[model samples]
Target: MNRAFNRKRDKTWMHTPEALAKHYIPYNAKFLGNTEVEAPKGTEVVEDAVRKLKFQRHIKKSEGQKVPKVELQISIYGVKILDPKTKDVHHNCQLHRISFCADDKTDKRIFTFICKDSESNKHLCYVFDSEKCAEEITLTIGQAFDLAYKKFLESGGKDVETRKQIGTLQRRIQELETENSELKKQLQDFEEQLMMVHGSPAGSISIQTQSTDVFDMVPFSPVTPLVPTQANNASPPPPPTTLPPDISKDLFGAEPFDPFTCASADFPPDIQSKLDEMQEGFKMGLTLEGTIFSLDPLDERC
Candidate 1:
């Protein structure tokens, strides 16, 4: 017994779950815990990258003193005053854009609080990494406009119904303008006809009344009764006449018929026969017995 039973060999076990959670795992662990390590501290330098985006410019600052930098610009109106191509010199559209100070401190740089176009007049904020891109990130004005607009529309312009309504209104406006132009052309033609009928230049007419139709000059007249003693009256009057069919039928119905309709008589006979053959083939296949039969296809079946 050299150690006299070694003092009964003291043994101790410690269960420190919280300490493990706070120290062992990085979930709540600090690298230097209240002690500054001898490492380079990150310096957050704001790098300025100027982007000449499409549409218009929106200064982030207010009109008064010390205007804040505008984070984004919305291209509510895009007027193409000049273009490389001469054909489309002046075309306008609705576009938008967003600009912000970038932080390229690391290879995996990130954009912080990216202010983008919002609804009618709002701004959106979010964070996105410049890395992890499946596609190349080439900066273009159009692309920037689209990005901001898309994000803004997703946020502020979330009302799909409203967008649909706006689209409908725009279409209606275009239709009205087209109709107005047609009407103006028709008016000019009528005026020319009037000038020819009057045997004078159209300019001779007063400017105020030039728009009026020449037919308007013909006033309504009452039927005058003829005396029975007239020599022509000796012949018996013709039988009562029937009304003519609507003369104005489809006077302006030049609009093309739906191309999808194959049932109309105007359809091509060859195409109609092919279609009938297809239908017959389909019908025969549906039946239990696969029997093929042919029917006399009408000339107007198409």
Candidate 2:
């Protein structure tokens, strides 16, 4: 039978009448501490009131930070199940996983459990202040144990898969090694063939020669010297002389027209008008300055 409810306030249990009678809520459900029950011995209390407090309650505040909170935690009858190493491993080899919302909108309480042996899997246990989380904790622990057990069964043995992978890798290595050995043998045979074909395997050979005149081999004492042909002798070239070129006429013919004295009428009408106006203004300004200096009454020296 499964336990299900909102562990915060809606504290309901999902179980048959027979299952509810058999399963008992412990008198002391406190984690890392002890508790006592005040109810009658056979009373049907759905839960124990003992709660798990924060680690800060036992810590001392030195300087600005809270120092380590120490506790004398004993697993009662088992080994030191509460490991100080801070790792998530629980009593069983399975991991200890817990989740909780610490906000004011939701009841801030944690629920946690671990997978026990298959014989004890029927009873899912948890520690939580909120009744909603407590019911959720029971169902979650049962599902976790079922899933973990299935995974454990699937990954139990290592012989078949491991051996197959090792055999495949070994075959591939052997194939590469065999191909390398065959190539080395072929290279050795080719080297031997080359040595047999070449005369000197270490170095090449050299052929030397000595020159001699052809007259020594023939009897040519009666032969006279032949007459020289016209092609045998060539005439010398004439000597070089320094001479100046005639300047009677220009080499480029007539000189080019002077661009400075060229007519401004060849330009566009607007450009010509601008140039003519500038020249006329200069002449008028010079005449006005000359007349002003000559006829000024303030110029006594003129």
Candidate 1 wrongly placed segments (more than 4 Å): 1-154, 201-302
Residue-pair clashes per prediction, in order, are 6, 6
Residue 141's lDDT in candidate 1: 20
Cα-lDDT of candidate 1: 0.27
Per-residue lDDT of candidate 1, residues 96-202 (tens digit): 31222222335333332222222332322222233432011211222323233334344433343343445466567556556655765676676556545533242
Predict model 2's lDDT versus the native.
0.29
Taking every candidate in turn, the Cα RMSD to the unseen true structure, in Å, is 28.7, 43.5
The ten-residue window of minimal lDDT in model 2 covers 286-295
Structural similarity to truth (TM-score) of each candidate: 0.19, 0.21
Q: After superposition, how far is residue 24 of candidate 2 from its true place, in Å?
A: 28
* Per-candidate local distance difference test: 0.27, 0.29
Worst 10 residues of 1 by lDDT: 25-34
lDDT of 1 at 99: 26
